[model samples]
Target chain A: MSEFEPKIVAYCCDFCAFAAADLAGAMRLQYPPNVRIIRLPCTGKVDAIHLMKAFEQGADGVFVAGCLEGQCHYLEGNLRARKRVAYAKRLLAEVQIEPERIDMFNLSSAMGGRFAEIVKEMTQRIKEMGPANTDRRQQPVES
Target chain B: MIVADRKPLEEILDSIKDYKKIMLMGCGGCVTICFSGGVKAVELLASQIKIARKKQGKPIEIIECTPERQCEFEFIDAFKKDLESAEAVLSIACGVGVQTMSERHEDTITIPGQNTKFMGYPVEHALWEERCAGCGNCVLEWTGGICPIARCAKKLLNGPCGGSSNGVCEVDKDTDCVWQLIYDRLKKLNKLENLMVVRQPKDWRTSTDAGQRRVKFEEAML
Candidate 1:
């Protein structure tokens, strides 16, 4: 059987993680191609519904990458993003999905290597969890 | 506002497990103000249920709608087309909205997604506390706007009952003794005499225990 290539969606803040991803390309850093990046004006715009919709649409994993904690370019967007990410994680957990399937990370635009590392880390995590919805099909019915 | 709490997701999922599609309704009235039933809540719940169903390999479809007031037939009647297509309805509004939908559409199965908690107001940013019992009587004039029927542990009319300690209810240490609040407010207003005039028992018929209550305005009848 072929290995499961989990699909990861990364919501990146334009001021930090998005630029960091760009920088990773410029640095010739090799990371898994499994993750797709969606650049947002600010991570604060990352609503819990948006994250769940991604999972509902078929994302194996999702993560929000924003400015390093106190360094949000828009002054508290990342903070709000972090709180929303935590709330989304709790919601996902209630649906029997792994809380680890969604996450939030902090990075500087200059930290291209860290950005690449986050992607690889997320990819690894999803691979371990298997695909979000499909994995249920493999289990025996409890009832 | 009528404050309510979303039923746990597991309970909500179980109620509509038999349906393949449903109209997930939200109210733009009191439940919206309380954050239990609103457009934002409806969207999040729909996505959560969809993802949960997908995980079980039984993907259910959902149609999200938020009316200005689900408890009003006129607003709900606007989406009769969607109503006819959906197999069931999962309402995130307060109890009144749920009952209203079921009453209007007798053929469609309507399920509640929240537990209507109380007639209350936001006590803080995200906290709501029961402020009124809807007892159909106005006792606030003498009680300084705090209702013992709703806020007090014993529902005592004139009391600092022995259970009140350090200005907090013994029922729950976190709750302030309503009688204490009344006394302080009345003392501030120099109307402590109102507390001394309690000579008769309250009419219990005004409360819910008597039966379902209704009001009709003869002049408003068409």
Candidate 2:
């Protein structure tokens, strides 16, 4: 059987995670190409609806990479994002989706190595989980 | 404000499963403030429903509308055309607003998308706590602005119930005994003597126990 290549969406905060991604490129770090990063002003800008919409648009996995705890550029944006990510997981589970498909990560802008590692780790986890059941029979939305 | 919560997605989906075209009516009043029913909520729900239906290969159409206040007839009238075209209406408003929709659009079926919770205020961003009981009586003056009817677990009018221990209600350990709050407030205000006066039982007729209630604005009469 051919190996699964998951479609992962990563929301990277501009001040840290996005910078880390840029650093990874500078350091010649290699990570799976399955991840597509969307840069945001802050992790707090990543709403629960955005995570759900990623799944709705056929993303196999979604992650929010934010600044390290107590080091957010916007004071508590990362903390708020962490809480929202937790909420999104429960919301996904309520709709019968795998909660593990979504996650939140925190790291400093200098952690380029860890940034690459997270991408590879997330890709591996999602690949093991296989493609999301986008084709599964969803509950009828409206009667 | 009247706080409400969205019904479970499964229940909401099930309620309108048979309809191909539906109107999602949002309210801009209390429900909007509570984040349960509003323009954004309507859009989010519509997108969710569309995605769910698409996955199942059972495409459905949703028309969205948000009125200033669903309970007001004037705001609901604005969606007359949309209401006519949709097979059913999913109202994400309080019970009063839902009823208004039904009354306003008697030819169309109106489904409630939220479970009306209580008259409360948001303590913080997303945290809401019940604050009013609408008991048709005003005793805040004697209680030093604290309401025993709503905040009290036992609704004791006289003093703290035996269940109160260390200022917490017995029914729920997390709940503060409202009687204790009232006592403290009265003590602070030097109105502790008010607690000694015996009060008559509340007249239930002033509340829902009198059946459907109405307020007629005499000055606004046509």
- What is the lDDT of every predicted structure here? 0.90, 0.88
Off by over 4 Å in 2: A135-143, B54-57
Q: Please, what are the lDDT tens digits per residue for candidate 2 over residues B1-222?
A: 999999998898899999999999999999889888988788778767766676666878889999999999999999898777799999999999999999988888999999998998988888999988888878888889888888886677889879999999999998889988888888999988998999888787877898887889999999
DockQ of each: 0.59, 0.32
lDDT of 1 by residue, B1-222 (tens): 999999999999999999999999999999889877999999999988988888787989899999999999999998889888899999999999999999999999999999999998888988999989988887898887778888887778876899888899888889998999999999999989999986477887998869999999999999
Q: Candidate 2, B11: how far from true, in Å?
A: 1.9
List candidate 1 stretches off by more than 4 Å. A134-143
What's model 1's lDDT at A4?
85
What is the Å distance of residue B145 in model 2 from its true position? 1.6
Interface RMSD of each: 2.2, 2.4
Clashing pairs in 1: none
